[model samples]
Target: MSTGELSDERVTAAVRDATAAPSMHNTQPWRFRYLRSEGVFQVRADFGRALPHADPDGRALHISCGAALLNLRVALAHRGLRPVARLLPDPGDPALLAVVRPSRPEDGGEGGGGEGGLGALHPAVHRRHTSRLPFTETEIPQALRTALSDAARREGALLDFPGPSHLRWVLQLVEEAEARNRTDRGEAEDLARWTRAGTAGTSDAAGAAAAGDGIPEYAFGPRRFDGRAPVRDFAGTGRVSGRRAATFERHPQVALLSTVKDRPEDWLRAGQAMERVLLLATLEGLVGSPATQPVEWPDLRWPLRDPVSGRGQVQTVLRLGYGPSGPGTPRRPTGEVLDIRP
Candidate 1:
């Protein structure tokens, strides 16, 4: 892992590991073009992969890229290589998310980097799935919640879980957000573009279709949204006209991850933190899903502010509980996402 001498082959293998990071919809809105001569892996945000109506300014695009960058770091470290990364390396090129170079080489070591219970958790990388399904009434251990909060803090973000008293208000916000999205013509169209079953490899706006990324119909749970746990219904797309409805976890534990300031860098940081929290949850044998419908609306955005902290905008709303982990969503191969420019 020398900055002066990086191989495209080795970088390709690393890029494979980086795609494990999660985004709003498993959009995988990122591309890595490696400059062999410079030994820099240029991480670029694929605007085409973005949900234009949902993320007009490409904030989510940057977050997804940031998550990939975090994965790149972990992948390199897992191989005993510390990659030198410059976030938003070129302001002139806005799509340029980061440039990574395999530097500070070392022997991968005797299972030292990934130690403790986390060592076991590392394997969850391949097992982690964004389950759009509901959880059984099975309760989650309180200890695991502590671990999740710790994981978020490790990446410079905080979690705010609402108490029973605040549940009614929180649900109000979620309802308001849902209502707004239902009427928002642009968002509905954008979702339709991304959620089509035929998008797998043929449809023009197949979005994550070819990549085998994004939520699939099998995982969309029920078309009907049960008020019990408050899960995000991707069924809103209306593509699957008729789908079975299942009983979800009675009380799905929902939490918000946020930063003190709302900015591109902050979103990136929050995204990285979100990935860690998710992986940690996966390690604990739990499933996590996202609900951005509320955060996407201006009217419902600031209302999610935690009463205690009284700061930071809610970047993500997650439903965490014990349930069967999701399936392996599709992804673009290493070659498609990683470019080696000699």
Candidate 2:
């Protein structure tokens, strides 16, 4: 993750490990170019991969990139390279989300998660997937929720969980985003293009003819009340031939990632927290999708911040529960997205 003379092995390892970051619909809208001497990992937003209609303000795009950035950090850590990340280092380089100078644990010490759990999530990285499936009737342990909140807090964000009243507020917001999106022809078209059933993704992993990178028939579950119950319907148009509609759980746990300000730095922080919670949740056998439904709308965005705490701007909402993790979607390979420079 540095510039000057780092080995190709080191940079490639970081990029490969970072791809484990979960993206909304696996957009994976990020590419990294590295400068070896400086140990700088330059993150570029692949606007070609942007779902503009669904994420008009490009917030989810940033969050996805941020998630990738977080993965880069962990990958570096696991490789005995501690990472010193400078987010949005240059305003002139807008696509460059960060520059990481690799640091060894010998320098930065060990994890803030403690030695025991320093990389408790290392295994979960490859295993984590979006779970649109319904969870069991059981509730999540309170202690784990506290731990997830702690993880988010450490990344400069807050996860405001839903109570009955708060849940209602979010349901309405989902409805609002869904309603607006459904009626817009442009939005529907965009979703159709990005959510294709069997088209090959740009990533190497998606090249198999029988495989799928975009949302496929086997996924998409049931219609979330048409307008919105929860979960965005990726296959509502009946693209998948034999895919059946099934029931999701009666209720899904929801949490929001929010930050104090709405600047690029805040967004980067929120994104890292988003990745942390998602990875932590996966390590705990929980799976869910990022519901950036509120962040997509200006009307719903500001109100999403906790009124009392006023802690941070709302970055994302996540629907989480115990269930079958969604099958691995697709990822563009490191070879296509990662560049090494002298």
Candidate 3:
């Protein structure tokens, strides 16, 4: 289909897929605006949903928007259009993270076709979820690991699967970060405001006001009673009446995603890279969860980088293996976040 034939329904569907991109605490911190006249979609950050304490510099916010941006590109590719994304298009407006224009494929037909193309991973857009549940001890195949790394590289980022010693040290940093968050008042408030308690899906009046954007109780997964996997407990110190405790993997297969430079543009690229890795993993029959607890702290985040190479900024930590996919979290309706203008 040509850009001239772009329909409102198509734009809305693409935005819906974009919203499925994971965010810090399921905040869904993004807004979409389609310029019908120009056939472009503006991806903006929703500061109202920002986590000031956890993401003070708005790095995570930008990453979240970047993930959505990648999904939008994938959605467009699946619909037989080629997506051209310009990052941080307007420096004057930092919130306007990106503007994506969908045009006809260069081949004058559907975009690239192959297991490695963006179109190939389009189905995983809706299937991918952040599984916080216990993953088995089975190690991911080297071939699959290489593919996941390539996915990150395609978007200008690096994905590293650390050795045993590095993995252990990274886990320790994650534990330390979690400990600090427990005592940090600001972080505590962020959690309380974004986490839903009581019945899994039932939201109180206060939660209703925010629409469906926070992490629901059911998606929190079981509390970590044993094992060393770096899963952040959204329950905090509070008690969830029926939440059961389970033992996570004794040896969790974790990976660190990083980039050469640390900037708004880099974070956005890292976010896109991260989502690409995730969608590919989902398509490969792997369940994964991202843990930013370590990266949220400056000191801990610094140590997460490679001790040998000592290059690249660690953006986020990921744990992947064979396990049940986590339940889908709440998302704001498409009408709530998208604006179309002629």
Query: TM-score winner among the candidates?
Result: 3
Model 3 lDDT tens row, 163-246: 989998999999999899888898889989998776364554345435587877788899999999989999888889888999
For model 1, how does the per-residue alpha-carbon lDDT over 112-150 read when each residue is reduced to its tens digit? 255432223455666777786668777666777777877
Q: Where does model 1 exceed 4 Å of error? A: 1-6, 105-112, 116-121, 198-214, 225-227, 237-242
Model 2 lDDT tens row, 1-342: 223335788789879878878766667788899886666788788888888676776777788888888888777666655567888878897888888777645533533334334355566677877766666546778998998898888788888787777777887887687677666776677767666554323443345313324554445664443223367767644455545456566666788778878877787788888888888888888887877666777888777666666666788888877877776665666788888887
Error of 1 at 92 (Å): 1.7
TM-score (C-alpha, index-matched) for candidate 2: 0.88
By TM-score, is 2 or 3 better?
Answer: 3
* Candidate 2 positional error at 160, Å: 1.7
Worst ten-residue run, lDDT, model 3? 201-210
lDDT for 301 in candidate 3 is: 94
The alpha-carbon lDDT assigned to residue 9 of candidate 3 equals: 96
Task: Write down the RMSD of all candidates, one decimal each.
Answer: 3.7, 3.6, 2.1
Clashes found in each candidate (C-alpha, N, C closer than 3 A): 5, 17, 0
Cα deviation at 59, candidate 1, in Å, is: 1.7
What TM-score quantifies how close candidate 1 is to the native fold? Answer: 0.87
Candidate 1 residue pairs in backbone clash: 200-209, 211-330, 211-331, 212-330, 213-330
Error of 2 at 46 (Å): 1.8
Kindly report which residue stretches of model 2 are placed more than 4 angstroms away from their true locations once superposed: 1-6, 106-118, 198-213, 222-229, 237-239, 307-311
